[model samples]
Every structure is written in C-alpha cells, then in structure tokens.
Target chain A: MTDNTRRRFLKTLLAGGGLATLTGCDYLSEKTWFRDTLAQGETLSDVVQHAVTPRKAMAREYTPADISPSFRANGTTDPDAVEYRMLAANGFRDYRLKVGGMVENPMTLDLAAIRALPSRTQITRHDCVEGWSAIGQWTGARLSTLVEQARPHPDARYLVFHCADRYGRSHSPYYESIDMEDAHHPQTLLAYELNGEPLPIANGAPLRLRVERQLGYKMAKYVMAIEVVESFDHIAGGKGGFWEDRGYAWYAGI
Target chain B: MARARLRTVYRHPLPVRIGHWVNALCLFILLLSGLQIFNAHPHLYWGSASNFEAPWLSIDYHWSRDDGYSGRTQVYGWQADTTGVLGASPGRNGELEGRAFPSWLTIPGSRWLAMGRSWHFFFAWILVINASLFLIWALFAGHLRRLIPTLEDWRGFGQSVLDHLRLRHPTGEAATRYNILQKLAYLTVIFGLGGLIVLTGLCMSPRMDTVLEPVLEFFGGRQSARSIHFLAAGGLVLFVAIHLFEVIVSGPVNQLRSMITGFFRYRDEPATDSATTRETRHDG
Candidate 1:
C-alpha cells in the first residue's frame, strides 16, 4: 500500500482504538472486573512502596517547634460510651489491651505493661484523608515489640486494631488493620503519649496505632484490642476498617 | 470560466482529537471530584504539617451575630469574606451549607468523602494513562512540533497578543497553522502544567510517597505537593475556560468540525488556486 493509504488506515485504527478504550473504561467500571482491578491496584501500590522505600525508612520527622498548638482531634472526638467514659474517668489505669486471634499465645496487657516496654518517640505529621495534617510528638512502645510478645502464628497476615469509637450506632465497632509489614515497621508505635504529656482522651489516650506512612484514619484511636488475622474477610463489612467498610480504600497509603 | 473548488485541510489528526476529548472528560471529573475531596478538609498548607493553629490557605464558613452567612477565605494570613461563593454557597438542597465548594460543584453532589476519593483515584488512573499515551504518540508522530514555540513564534507572539486583544483572528494562510499564542498555550497545558499536576498528585499519595520521596522533596513536602496540585488544577480550569471561549470566538462550527471529524474548511475563494496548492501540501 502507498504511504498515504497506510497512514489513513492507521489513523482510522487508532481512532477506533481510542474510542474503544474510552468506552471500555465506562463499561469496565460497572463490572466486577474493574472493582477487583482497583483492589489489586491498591496492592500494587503497596508493593511499589515497599520496593521503592528502604525497609527502615521513616516518615518525615519534625522538631518540637513544628508541633501544632491544637491538633484538633478528628473522626470520633469523644467515644461517649459508658465503658470508655468509665475507663477515662479513672485515667485508664484499668484499661487492658487484649492481643489474640491467630496468635500462638493470647495475652492481655494493661496500660502500665504497655508503657513499660521499650519505646520510640517520633515527631511526625498526621495526614488526614480530608486533606488536613498536624504534627505531634508521639511516645509509645514499638508495635513490633508487642507483636513479638504475642507470637503471631505463621498464618497471620494482618494486625487488626479494635477501637472504642463506634459511629452512628453501627452494629460493628470502629476498627482498622495493617499488613504484617506495617505492623513490624520500626516506626509503627502504639502511642500512649503526645507532646511530652500522656495522650489526651480526644487523641486516643491509653493507646493509638501510629502507622505514620498512612493517613490519619488508619491510626485507629482508643485501641481496645489487637487481633492478628490471616485475612479481614470475616471482619466487619469484610473490608477492614469502619471507614473502609463504608467505601474508603482499605489500603489508604496513597 | 471554471471555478476552483474550496480547499479543506486536515486541521486535527485522529490522535489529537481522541486525546483532547479524553483529557477533557478526565479534567471535568477530576476537578469536580477534587473539590469534593477538598470539602472534606477545606484548608491547605505549605509545609508538611498544619492544624487549627496555621494554614497558608483555608476556606471555611462561620456564623456570628455581626457576619451572618459569611464564608471566609484566608490566604497566607490575608482573610476575606467570599460569602456568596467559594467557602460556602447554597447547597443542592437549597440550604446554606458550610462547605469549601458547594455540593453542585462536587461529584456525588454530597459530602461522601469516600465515594469522592474512589471517583478521584479511578479517574486519576484514566487521566494519567491517557495523558501518557497521548504524549508518547504526539512525540513520535511529530505533532508536538506544531505546539512547541520557536524563535519565530517569539517574534510573532506580541503581534498575536495584540490581535487577540482586538479580537482579530488569522485569515487564510495564517489560519492554516496555530498562531504563536495557541502554540504557547497548548505547550503549557500539555507539557508544563499537565506534568506538574500529575507529579504533584502522585506526591500526595501516601504509597507513592514511599516510591517518590526524593521527587516529592523537590516540591518541599506532602502538603506543598497538595497545594501545588490545587493550584495547577486552577490553571487547568482557567485554560478550559479560555479554550472554550477561543473555540467560540474562532468559529465554533469550524473548530468543532475539525476536532470531531479531522476536516477543516477554509474560507471560500473560488478563483484562488493558492488555497488548493497549500491544502494539497498539508494533505501530502
């Protein structure tokens, strides 16, 4: 074929291809295939993140000068539950964090025991899904230390955080989960203190997960229990967290 | 005497047309969804950290006895009451809602942040992929040459601006190719601003941050990336407004036809063979 005709033919083919791709996006979004692909996309990002960043790489840390005066607690500001209120009333001295599910040894540790473990202090920014951020110094026990004591079974793949906050009277309580990789990260802390003082009630007093690389919502506040699980399939809404169940991406790293 | 046929040119190639429409759709979805996402937290910051204490930019609504129904915007410590628009507006429900941008302007048209994020991320993939493909194709096909400014373009730029100010458009031979103004604008949109938007967007991703930490550092921090993302989006919105205006001003029928079908008819001059020769050259 002559160059002119070949060019014309190719142009037509390209236009057809472009049109197909555009329509394909529309049709695919409605299909289960697309949803699964997006889910995979989340995993893809996780893989890429792990591949690119060094294992011990930390989230950017700030000095005390950068700390916000009022961090302005997000999500559930106050867990107004009778149990949570009573626990808070007594300075959470009696609070116990149960560590079970897919673990070789199930153990419950009180606030004192948790605070006694070797700790990590980091002044890091908390980026919220809502596009706000705040810096605060978090002092807590390394989650890996707790995971080591719990002795998660080989089948365990995720660390689930069960929290005190339940919104809108949902039958399911507020919870969040992270993969084993995040659970073992050196910076992943079960923070009990903020800005030199004990963590305040609004900021998840007795305990809060500090998965620094992720968004604010992933840091489950007022953590009541820690569960090791192979998958979150049987968890509330089968997505992972309260927000995840409501349609937020379970892997909110991006 | 026999009359010459009116000449037509291949003003827009198939690939260009396809890229244009896809980007347009992506931008529309992105802007609306971005606003929806912004409504989740109406404040913007410069450094990596921000809270109630300080934000370089913030859009919020507050009620006071003196300033009822006022919507405030503060930028770098300078505050203003943009009440009728921006910070707050009459929501879709017709109630005065305190949102950064009104519900009508947001995707899902409600305060469903999760849904907004889903839409944003989904469309973001589409935009990124589509734009990447378009760039590659444009480069390989040499279509980029038409958009990139030259020394001659610089010489003609002032004239083009003057003509634009007077609402004058090129005629005949000059109209066959994009004017300097068009080239510069297209180049900025395609190469400069488009890449900035995408890079800043990637920088905002917590996962991508791990992968692109060094690149994100160039933008300063995550919050800086977010701020740049929003600002670049504003530039895009401005481009679309001016683009649509130019389309209408330059003869929407001809512009629309060229983009839709790749055929553009020039002004008729039955006695002129120059137009036909030039058209043939373009076709060849």
Candidate 2:
C-alpha cells in the first residue's frame, strides 16, 4: 500500500475517537461504552483543565530544628556520568543548569549566578505521596527569576525539570513539570542548599525544585536542565512525569 | 442443558442485589453531593473533581446547609429537579459532601448536613452491613477464589493485555465476561475502593484520622488520603460503568438473571466457548 493510504489507514485504525468503529460491541450501548471507556481513562488535556487552580495549596510550616539529620533520597542516589561525577567530586561548584525550550534566549546559569539572585529560605514539611513526610529548611533562588531571565514564550504553559536520576528498572529519566502558577509561586525555588550546607546527593544535591504546593515527587532532584513548553504532548509518554505515565495522576496538587 | 443448569444454581443473592442498589444509591448521592462541595470552590486541577462548574446546569438555592462546622453553603446536585423518583432528596450517608448540593445547578439546599450527618452516619451502617455480609458470603461461598483468578488466568490476562495493546478486532467473549480484564478491574476496585476507601474515610474525620494514620501514611498524607478517597470513588464509578457495559454486551437480561436469580444463562457459542462453560461462576 502507498504511504498516504497506509497513513490514513493507520490514523483511522489507531486514532482514538467515536464509537462507530467499535466492532462487535453489539452488547454495550455505543454511547455507554464510549463514556465508560473514555471517562475511566485519563487524558493529558483533560488533566490540564482539571488541574487549573484558584485554590491554593497550604504550605505546612515547621520549626527549624525539626530538620532531619540526613534526608534520605528515595531515588537516584548518584548521576554517575563523567561530567556529573566530575562535578560531584568537586561538590557541584562548576555545575550550571541550562534553561531552554520555547524560550527567546536559552541560557545556562551557574550555581553562584543562580544564588546571586534574590533568595528564599522556607522551612516546610515535604509530604511524599509514597506515605512519608519530612521537614527540611530549603534555601535557594526564586524559580520566577529563572523564568524571567529565560523569557518563556507566551504560549509556553509548563516548566519541565529534567533531572539526572532515572527511576525504577525502566532507566527512564526522572522528570517533572509545573504550570505557570506554581512555577511563579513565592515559595517555589530552585532549592540549592538543605539546612545550612550544600544539598546532599541523597536529597537532590546542587540544585532541585522546591514546589511546596505539591507532593515531594513534584520536586525534581539533581537538576541538569529546565524546559519551558506549550504542552506535554512531546514529552515522554506525553503525560508530563514518570509516575504519571504509569497510572499516577499528573497534577498532584496536594 | 445449560438453561436447566442455570435454573438450578444461584448467582446474585437477594441481599447482594439490595446492596447493589443501596451502593448505587449511596454513590450517586455521594458523587453529586461531592460535586456540590466541589462547586463551592470549583477549581479542580486534576484527579476526579474539577474547579469548573457547568453554568447551564445551575440551580440557585435560596438558603444554606447545616454542616455544624460551616454554614450558609449553597450547592446543587446533578439532576435538574426533584420531579422523578431518583430526583427526590437523595440522602448523604456517611459521605464526604456532608450536605447541600450547589444552588446554581440545583434547587434550594434541602439536606441539612446535620440531618445529612444522621443519614450519612445511618447509611454508613448500611454500607458496613452490606459490605461485611457480602464479604462473608463471598468468602464462605468460595466466591472470592472464583472471582480472583489464579496463575493460569494471568496468562489469559496477559494475552488480553496484548490484544488491548494491539487494539485488535472488536471486544469479543473475552471482553464480555470479567475475563482477565474483568478480574483486574474488579481487583483494582476491591483494593482501591474496598480497602483504601474505608481507611481514608476514617482518616478524614478528626475522630478517626489518628486511628487510621498509619494506613493513610502508606498512601501519602491526610490530604493525599482525602485525594485517594476521591480517586477511589471515581474508580468505583468507573468500575460500575464498565460492569454495566459488560452485562449489556453479554445481554443484560441473561447477566441480571444470573445475579438476581443466581444462575448465569451462558450463550453456547461452540465456535468460541473455551473460556468457561458453567451455570454459575459465582464470583459474587
């Protein structure tokens, strides 16, 4: 078959749409089946609309002394690549985070430059969706500054964080994203230091996201890059995050 | 011979039927009432609830609800009005929505959440009773083992997964019965709704949050537990929807007859009758 016909055929066969093509579904009412199937399955677009929020996430506050002696990192202990290990050996002094994707000027800012921007230090409870909680003092540059410097395109809606760690057995890159609102929240920061010292590898060392409004996983660790994009369509599996692709909700706004 | 066999065995217990209807009634009220609560804020970003409220479907109530904790709340349920049998005041039985449907899409807020609390607390007993009895019946009657598949069934499930992945031909008999697909779906609802729900529901209330804190932590936090409760409710609704479709696909009367009267009248398709041939696979 010609490429045109094959493409059209594939589109008709695989494209998700109406129930007219539901062969042999004589038992289920077409409408009922369609509704049940579609409603049960979460779509990326539907999720974005649902997650738009006027409702604010209350940040749980904590005493400075409540910080853990050592915050155990759940995933990605070390990014063993040559460049990352070299930086890790020197304690990320030379590390620079590149911010690009749908931006006017793609720029790389070093840790010092990022720290030079106005900073915020907030001691809040980090609630992990996996059923654990920790309180830590996070100090870093306001995320909004980075977004301002990068000057994300008008259509750009999500701020994607590309981390150095890979999750589970899939070896898939650990990444996370947030809408414009969370990206610019006052408490949201590119957390560089935990407590007083530089962030430990176990706790997303050098630079990590601190989106207090969301669960712990929303805070991408071992940050190597940030991408501002229009939608999550081109991202891995198009659902926005690693866990979200595997049946977990994408906008975990609690 | 199959019809005679079906005539002898029982499928859906009378009490189970009652529970089905009760559970249906409870969930409908819960979802709509929950929607009413959601309408109060109306800004959902993900999961089951949304912040957006349908304007055309708005009912402006003249008054407020009785939650004891909060007052002067206006909300509406999904249905247009209370003209029909199901439309009349649907009570909130131990539900999250407490009381009061949104007013924009509903009539006056009739349910006093205080009174709604009584109904909620009351129906909670109904739920517990129905669920407990169903559990006991399923266990004592060997229905759990029948419903939950074994290692052999996993292969069928895996094959079904590949079929679904391929998006091959229409949903055949394998799709009709609670095939491996059905088993997994049921298993999800069981673990999601049956277990997490009770645990989360307890966690939400100040009185019981402490008791169920450990279990709640297994999922996330108090807020996460509440979110899980909502997610599980959505999952249950999804399960019920697929289940009804499965029944309809195989012929509703034939499926319902088995549950109501206790024996499933299986259509003998000699061409594709290899899955299981029996009067009742009572995974009730």
Candidate 3:
C-alpha cells in the first residue's frame, strides 16, 4: 500500500511540472498588474522600514587591515585608451572634472582643487552585481558638497557620470546617471582612496565616484567627468548605466 | 569487502529530491546575496523608501591622533562607541562574478542574482507540488487516517508537549517514525516556507501587485516582502540546522536509506514496548 502511494506521489510531482510552464510571452502583451504596492498596507512596509532603518544607511565598514588585497576591477577599470595613459603618466595633474549642465555655476575643477574642497571619509563595502564584495576606507570630497558648490539649477533631477570606458563598438562613452535622492546621499563621494591609500590605477586612479547607496556599477569606477543633467535621455545608452541599458533595473536597491 | 545489501525499495522521489537540493542551493545563494543587500542598509522597515541614508543616523568616525602623525599611532574607532560593524564581503574572488542573468531569462543573471531567482522559483514549485502530492497521497492511502494519530495522539501529544516544555522525554513512547513534536514542527515549516516564498514573490513581483495586495498589506508592503523573505529564509535555515541534528541522532544511513528506498529497514533493538517493535536493531 505504502509503495503504491509513494509511486503515485512521485508521478504526481512530475505531472504538476507539465501545468503550463511559463512561456514568457504573455507578460508584455497583458495589462501588466504588478506595480501598485500601495493598496496593500505597503505603507506598513514603509512604517517598519522607517522604524528600524538608519536615518543614513551605513555600509559595514572595515579597517585597512580588513581590505581585500586583490579587488577584481569589474566593468571597465581604467578609462579606455591612450588619453587615459597620458593622464596616468602625468599623474592626472591636469585632469579636470567638470560639473556643468543644469547647474547655476558651471565649474571646471582640477584634481588638486577638488581635493582641496571639504571632504568626507567613509569605510564602506563595494557590492558588485557579479556576486562579490570588498570593504575599503574611501576618503574624498562629499558629492553633496560638490553639488552644493555647483548649485544645480532647480530643474536638475539627475547627476550623470560620463566615463572613458566603452564596451565593444559603441561610439558613445560609457556613462551612468542617478536621481537627485542618491545625489545628496551622505555616503556618496567623489572617492580618491581605497583602503587608506590613493586610488590605484586599475581601480580608477586619480578619481572615481562612489554612490554607495546603489550597486558597484553605479559607483562608476574610472570616472572622467561629472555632468549635472536635467534628464538622462541625451546620454549614451539612454537607460542610465552601462548595464542598465542592457535591461537591468535602474534601481538596484537590494 | 564486507557484504552490502540494498535496504528497501523506497527512496525520495527524483522530483522531490531535486526540489530539496535545489531549494537548498537557492536558499544558500539567496542568503549570501541577501546579506550583501542587507549590508547596504542593515536595518529594514516596511516602507518604499528609507532614510537611514539621512545624515543624522550616521555614526561618526574619528581618528584620535597619537602624540603626532609620525609619532604615536592613532586610534581608529567609532566616535560614539557602538559596534562599527567592521567587516568585508564574500565572493570577492571566485568562479562567479558579474554573471548577471538577463532580464528575459528565467534566472536573472548569467551567474548570480538572476540564477538565484530562477533556481529559487523553480525549486519553489517543486517543493509545493511534491508536498501537496504527498499530503494527498497520504490521505488517500489510509496513511493519514491510520498512521496519523487519534485520541491517543492527543494524549501522547499532551505528554509530548510537557516533555518538550520541560526539555524531557515522556515515558510512554520513544518517538518512532515521528513523534507528536515532529509533526507539529514539520507541518509548521511546510506552511511557513511555502507561504513565505509565495508572499515574498508576490510582494516583489511587479506583476502580482493588484491580486496579492492584501498579502502585502498583511505583511506590510513590498519592503515587508523583503523583510518577510529575509525572516523566512532565516527560519528555513534554522529548520535545516535542527533537521541535520535529528538526522544525526537517528542514524543517517538508516533514516536516509528509508527516505531514498521508500521502506524503513526492519531493525531490532531493545526499544519495543508498544507498536515500535521491541529489540530493534538497525542493520543499515
């Protein structure tokens, strides 16, 4: 009796697998009902998150001793090509990071000038989409401080990062952008250090942007310039980040 | 070599076994990646947006310079003196990195998040189907009516409750097959894990927003789904831990062989008093 029942159960398990396995074709054509989290006391999700959540999210920091020895540089590490080499050879002495477009004050600041600006230090982990992580002490000027200095125009809704790295035959440069909320985030910084030392060449030497709130790709290593844009449509890829253009979600909070 | 013999004709069905291991793997990956996500904001809440990113909640960091920069070493610590939660990350160097599954694919990425999702969802169906099938099969096969307890179960159950409450075993029966305690716990897990995945998937899915909004409300919201998912995963982990302990105590080969072969190896030891068969010996 038990034997018969067990076999039946096994057969049923397999049979259930045949119940219309997802064809993946219906989603785009349908009315698409999955967007409203508000109807359900999603407000409750909000309330609880607010209660336990930190006012400012802090990455689990580590001492220099805890920093990884070999942090694999993902995406594009050094900005592409010979111009970056020339800059690297000269220690990026004359490199300029411009924060214009949609800003009241268009400023062109050299590496030294930007470094001279008030800075913030944070020891945070860099979360990569590739399934790895690393903790490093990053010291640099707060991105907010720079945003304040640049005084973005009232309509500026996003901050786009223009980079020198590109994959394949794309004529446009590798670029990424984030909303104003991430823009003013306290952890966000134009980082110049990994661990307690200067940013290594393979790790975006001379400068990089760290929007700690998002994934590592959002951090945009090998960043060449900061563009304060009113919208992201005009930029390369148009979807936001190098990966985002490829169908990755714009908001990778988790 | 010593003589070895096949114990029974029963074993875990292939689909059930596949589901079990796949769920295990998915849960492991989810936990690891989930930890990385949680590290972004350790504490979670019920809302769409959280302000833990605000400046006020930030713990201050200060370096107390020794006598001088070149002289005494500085003390590196949090200014307020709570656990700095100082740590690094896992998977920094491994076979898997950036292998994000494509959006259109069943899994989410080539190797990481997407695959975890795919495995998790696929195994979820396996678990649900197998569990349901087993329950129905048990009911139809007279196993539920006969093997499942009676008034005796309640009495045994009361004593069992007392035993567990007092952290002692009852005198009436040493649990065979399964005790009252096992039934309650396993049933609870079956429900909890199953419900959690469904609830979380509903909460996370951009597609289920309207249909399962009540569920989201019951838990809280989308973020609540995340919270529940995390909690549920943690609970399943606990279940796995305790399950391993029981498997160890029960004699791994004997119990496992029964599950695999679908027949308990008849054994004789000095354990019989009621229906458990006295003088049972495990020869697996």
* The best candidate in terms of TM-score: 1
**Can you tell me which runs of candidate 3 are displaced by over 4 Å?**
A1-55, A168-172, B1-183, B186-284
lDDT (tens digit, per residue) of candidate 3 on A19-102: 222222123212223212211223233343334545465544445665555665776655657888788889889688878888
Question: On residues B120-144, what C-alpha lDDT tens digit does candidate 2 reach at each position?
Answer: 3334445666778877887887767
DockQ, every prediction: 0.32, 0.01, 0.03
Q: Given the true complex, what DockQ would model 3 score?
A: 0.03
Question: Pick by DockQ: which candidate is best?
Answer: 1
Of the two candidates 1 and 2, the one with more favorable lDDT, higher being better, is 1
Error in Å for residue A46 of model 1: 4.5
Which 10-residue window of candidate 3 chain B scores lowest in summed lDDT? B67-76
Best by lDDT: 1
Q: What local distance difference test score does each model get?
A: 0.81, 0.59, 0.56
Ranking by DockQ: 1, 3, 2
Q: Model 1: per-residue lDDT, tens digit, A101-195?
A: 99988999998899899999999878888887778999999999889998999989999999998875574688999989889898899999999
Ranking by TM-score: 1, 3, 2
Each candidate's interface RMSD: 4.3, 16.7, 12.9
Candidate order by decreasing lDDT: 1, 2, 3
In angstroms, give how far residue A182 of model 1 lies from its true place.
0.6
lDDT of 1 by residue, B116-163 (tens): 676677778778888889889988999887787789778777777877
